[model samples]
Target: MTDTPGWASPGTAPSNEEREPGASGPTEPADRPGHTPPAPQPGAQPPGPGVKWSKEQPPPGQWSAPTGAPSPQQTPPPPPPGPGWTGQPPGGYGGGYGGPPAGYGGYGAPGGPGAWGGGWGGPPPAAKPGVIPLRPLGVGEILDGAVSTMRTHWRTVLGISLTVALLTEISLVLLQGFVLNDALAQVRVGNRAANPDEVFRALPDMMIGAGIIAVVTTIAVVIATALLTTITSRAVLGRTVSLGEAWRDARPQLPRLFGLILLLGLIVFGVMAGGALPGILVMAVGGDVVAGAGLLVLGLLAASVVTTWLVIRFCLSTPALMLERQSVVKALSRSAKLVRGSWWRTFGIMLLTGLIVRIVQVLIAIPFAVIGAAVSGDGITDLLGTGGGHTGWAYLIIQGIGALIGSALTLPISAGVTVLLYIDQRIRREALDLELARAAGVQASGAGAPGPVPGS
Candidate 1:
C-alpha cells in the first residue's frame, strides 16, 4: 500500500510491519529456494562481460557451472554470440535451431524417445538424411522407406538393379535360345510320349542347363544385395552415397556372401529332398497312381512348411553378412537371433513384400509377355516353352527386353524391404535407433549413446 508503507516515498520504502513481508523490496528481488541475493559491492557495475556474475545458486539436483553448462530443470539458454552464431538471441526466435528444436532425445525431449519403439509416444519424429525416419518403423513407413530410397537414390538404386537385371536377362535369354529350345525340340521331333521314362531320359540334360542358370542367378543376387546393402547403410544415416563408394564398401564381403548363399541353398535342398524322399520312392516303384499322388502331395506339403520356416529364420542373413561383415555361420546365427521372437511379424512382412514384388513383376512382364505371344501367334504353352515348339529367336529377344525392365524396377523394392526389415527388427530388439541417430549425426540430450530398448 503506497499510503501505509512506513510513510513510503522514493528512497524510504515501507518496512515489513507496514507491507507484505515477502513482497519485492525497493533495491532487490525476492529470494528463491536455492538462491541468495548478493550483497552490494562497490562499483560492481552489474557484472559485465568476462566477469563472473555473483552467486545465483541452482536448486538441488541441478549441475552448476559457467557458460555452456546446462540448467537442471529447463532448456539451457544458448551461450553468448560466438563465431558463426549469426548474432541471434539465446533460445528464442532465430536464436535456436533453424530447423525444429529437436532435443537430442528427439524433438522437445519428451520422455526418452518412447522406449526405442515399444511405448507409443505418438509417431516418432521424422529425422531426415535417410529416406526413412530414424525410428522403429510402421508398415507404411517400411514401404515408404523403400520407395523413398528408390526416388532419392535413383541413380544408385536403379543402376545396381538394372545392371543385375540386364545380366540376369542375358543369361536367361541365352539359356532359352541355345539350350531349352533345342532340348525340347528334340523331344517333339521324336514324337515321343510324355511319359516318366521320356521325361527322365531328358532330365540329365535339363539338370546341366539348370545348374548353369543357378550359378548365374546366384551371382546376380549376391551383387544386387551387396550394392543395396551399402546403399541402405548410408541411407540409414541419411547420407548420400555413390555407386563407386557402395562398391568399395561392399566388395570385400561378396565372396563370403556368395559362399553363404550356396551353403544355405544346399542345406535347404537337402532338407527338402530328404523330407520328400518317401514320396519319391513310392512314385519310383510305380505303385497305385492315387496312393502315390497322395503320398507325393503330403511329402511336398511337409517340405514346403519346413522350407518356409527355415527361410524366415535366416532371411536376415544377407543384411547381417554384408552390414555386419560376418562370416557365413555367424551371419546365420545373427539372423536367427534377430528373427527368434518376432517370427510371425517378420513372416507377415516378408510374405506381403514378396507378394507386392511379384505383383509388380507380373504387371511389368505381362505386356511384354503379350507382345511376345502376339508376335509368335503361338499358344500359351509355346510362349512358356511347352510341347517343344521352341520359342523363336524373335520371341526370345522381345521377352528378354520385358524381363530386363521388370527386373530393373522390381529389384530395388524387393531388396529394400528385406534390408529395412532387418533394420527394423534390430531397432526393436537392440536399441539400434540410437546408434542410427548417432551415425546420422543426430543424438540424445548430449548423452553419449542411447541405451537398450525397453522390452528388449
Candidate 2:
C-alpha cells in the first residue's frame, strides 16, 4: 500500500498488505471441493491384513488442517465426548472445518461472512489541503479550483487584475479620444464611391491606432497573467499572497514572458502568411483571379485549423514558464509534453473558460455601452453596430469603468484555470501529487491536514 491514499506512483505493484487474506497463500485440504472422508472414527474398524491405503489420497485420519483457522500446533486435542454429547467439537459451533469461529457475527453483522464477500469500497479519497485535491482532477474540479482561488485570494487577485485592466482601458480611451477619433471620422459609412480617397487616406492611421491598442493590451495581459499565475500556485498550497509578493515573484519572468508572447504571435503570423502566399502569388501573376480567391479562402481555413491546434498545444506555456522558471523555449516544450495525449481535453476546457469569460464581459459591457450611448445622445443600435459618430469623454470613461469591473472579475479566473490545468496535467503524468503532498505537509495517511507552510 502507498503511504498516502491514492498517491501510488505509476508501475509499482500492489503490496500483499493491500490484498485479501488467503488470496495467494497456500491452500489446505478442507478448502478443496470434496471432503477428506471424516477422520477415521476412533477404533471402529481397520483394514484387513495385507490391504494397503493409497499414498496419493491420504487416509481420512491424516487429512490436512482447514484453511483460515488455528493450526494443529496452536490448539490441544478435543476432550472425549460424554453421554448425549451429539458429536459437537470441543469449543462450540465453528470449532472445526469451514464454519467461522464462534462470536464472529452471522450474515449482516460487522466482520461477518458478508464482509468477506468483497465489496471493498472505492479507493480512499485524495488529500485536499487547498483548492484542489491532490490527484488527477476532473473538469468541474479544475473550474472550481480556479474560482476558489479567486474567491479565496480576492485582495491580491483583484488588485492585480484591476490595475492592469484600468491601465489598458486608460490607454485605449486616450488613443480613441485623441488619435482614432478624427481618423475614423473621415470614412463615410455609405457612398463608398464618393469617399474612396477618404477611406484610403484613413486606413493607415486606423491600422496604426489599432496596432498600438493591441500592443498595449498584450502588455497588460502579460502582467496580469504573470502575477495571477503566481498567486494561483500559492493558493493551491492553501497559502495567501500579497500583490507586492506576487509582483516580486513574477517580475523576473516578465521579460521572457513578453518574448514568448511575441514569438507565438510571429509564429501565428508566419503560418497565416504562408498559408495565403500561394494564392497571393497567383493573383500577383495576373492569372485565374477567381481561382486564386477560392484558393485563398481554402488556405485561410486550413491555416485556422493549424493555428487552433498550435494554440491549444502551447496554452500551458505561460504557467510553465512562470512557475518552473524555465526558458521560453523550454516552457514551450514543456507545454507540448504535458498536452501530448490530452489535446482535446485541454482544448475543451480552455474553450469553456473562454466562453465564460466572454459571456461575463458582454454582460458587463452591454449596460455600460447602452448608458454611454444614451448619455452621448447616440442610439444604442449605432453603438452596438457601428462605432457611432460620437464617443465623448463621458462615454469613454463610463465604458472604461465597466471594462475595469469585468476584467477584474474575469482575469484571475482565466489565469487560475491555466495554472491549475498545468498542475492537473502534471499530477496525472508525473505523479506530482506526491510532491505537493509533501510540500503541504500532508500526513502519510492524509488525515493530518497541516496548516499552510509558515513562510509561503
Candidate 3:
C-alpha cells in the first residue's frame, strides 16, 4: 500500500498523513455504475491527447487496504462513500474498475462530455492569491484587471500616463496655437490671391508643420506604450511600483519596443503595397482599366487578411518581451504559440476593444468640438479670412483638454488589457499561474486560480 499525499482525492487511497492517528485509508465501495472520478491534483500534468484523466484501477489485484487487513488471496471491494466522497452528485467519487463515467471528456477534448461534464480533470482552478487570479481569464475579468490596477495603483499608473499625456498635449497645443497658425495664415492668403498657383506654393510649410505634429505625437505614444506595459505587468501581480521604478524596468526595452512597432508598421505598409501593386502597374502601363481595378481589389483583400493575421499573431509579443525579458523575435514566436488555438477569440476581443475605444474618443471629442465652436463663435470670419485664419485660442485649448483627458484614460485601459490578455494566454498554455504566484510571493498550493467571485 502506498502513502497518499494530502491533496489526493477520494478515489485515491489515502496515506497516513491524511487519516486519523492509527486509522487506515477509507475502504473502496462496492461496484457502482455512473460515478465520476476525482480531479487531478494541482500539479498533475494535463492528460495526454486521447487519454482521459481517471482514477487508477486498483492494480487488477489488491483493492483498498482495510484497517483490519484482508486475508491473503481475497481482494477488498472499491471504497465506501465517506466524508469527502459520499456518492456525491459531483464530488468526484471514483467508479468501479473503469475510468470516469461512460463518455467522459475534458473541455476541448473530442466528444467531450456534456456541458456540466466538460470532463475537466480537476475542479475549476482555484483563485491564485494575486492581483489577477492565475488562470485563463474571461473577457470581463481582463477588463476588470485594467480598471482594478488603475484604482489600486493610481499613483503609478495614472502618474505615468498623466505625465506623458500632459506634456504631449502641451507641446501639441503650442505647436498648433503658434507655429501652425502662422503656416495656415499663409495658405489662407494664398487662397484669396488671384493666381491659384499661390495656394499650391504656400502649402508646403503647413504640410511640414503637420508632419512635425505627427512625428512628435507618435514619439509620445511609443514611449507611453512602453512605460505603461511595464506598470501593468507588475500591477497584475498585486505589486505597487513607483514611476522611477517603472521607468527603470521599461527603459531597457524601449529602444527595441520602438523598433518592433516600426517594423510592424513597415510590414503592414508592405502588405498594402504588395496588394495594390498589380493594379497600379496595370493602370500605369495602359492595361485594361476594369481588370486593373479587379486585381487591385483582390490584392487589397489578400493584404488585409495577411496584415490582420500578423497583428493578432504578434499581439502578445510586447508583454512577452517585457515580462519574460525575451528578445523581440523570441517573444513573437512565443506569442504565436499561445495564440495558436484562440485566434478567433483574440481577434474578436481586439476588434471589439478597438471599436469601443474609438467610440469613446469620438464621444469625448464631439462635445469638446461643439464647445470650442460655440466659444470661438466666429467660424464664418475664419472661413472668410476676416479673422486672419484665426479661431480663438480658447477654442483650441478646450479641444486639446478634452483630447488630453480622453487619451489619459484610454492609454491605460488599452495597454493593461493587452498585457493581461498576454498573461492569460500564457496561464492557459504555459501554466503561467505558477510563475505569477511565485513572483507575487504567494506559495503555490493545492488551490488553483478560480473563477471570479461575484461581488468580490
Q: Residue-wise lDDT of candidate 1 within 154-271, one digit each (tens)?
A: 9999989998999899988988788876556545544455665565445445645765676576567656866898887778777889999988888898789888888877877777
Better of 2 and 3 by lDDT: 2
In candidate 3, stretches whose alpha carbon ends up further than 4 angstroms from where it belongs are 1-76, 80-125, 166-222, 279-301, 377-397, 445-456
lDDT for position 5 in model 3 = 24
RMSD of each: 14.2, 13.6, 16.4
lDDT of 3 by residue, 378-409 (tens): 65454344455656788788888888887787
After superposing candidate 1, which stretches have Cα over 4 Å from the reference? 1-126, 178-219, 377-388, 444-456
C-alpha lDDT of candidate 2 relative to the true structure: 0.71
Displacement of residue 292 (Cα, Å) in model 1 is 3.5
TM-score of each: 0.64, 0.68, 0.60
* Ranked by lDDT, top first: 2, 1, 3
Q: What's the lDDT for candidate 3?
A: 0.67
Ranking by TM-score: 2, 1, 3
Task: Give lDDT: candidate 2, residue 414.
Answer: 83
Error of model 1, residue 203, in angstroms: 9.3
lDDT of each: 0.69, 0.71, 0.67
> Which of candidates 1 and 2 reaches a greater TM-score?
2
Point out the higher-scoring one by TM-score: 1 or 3.
1
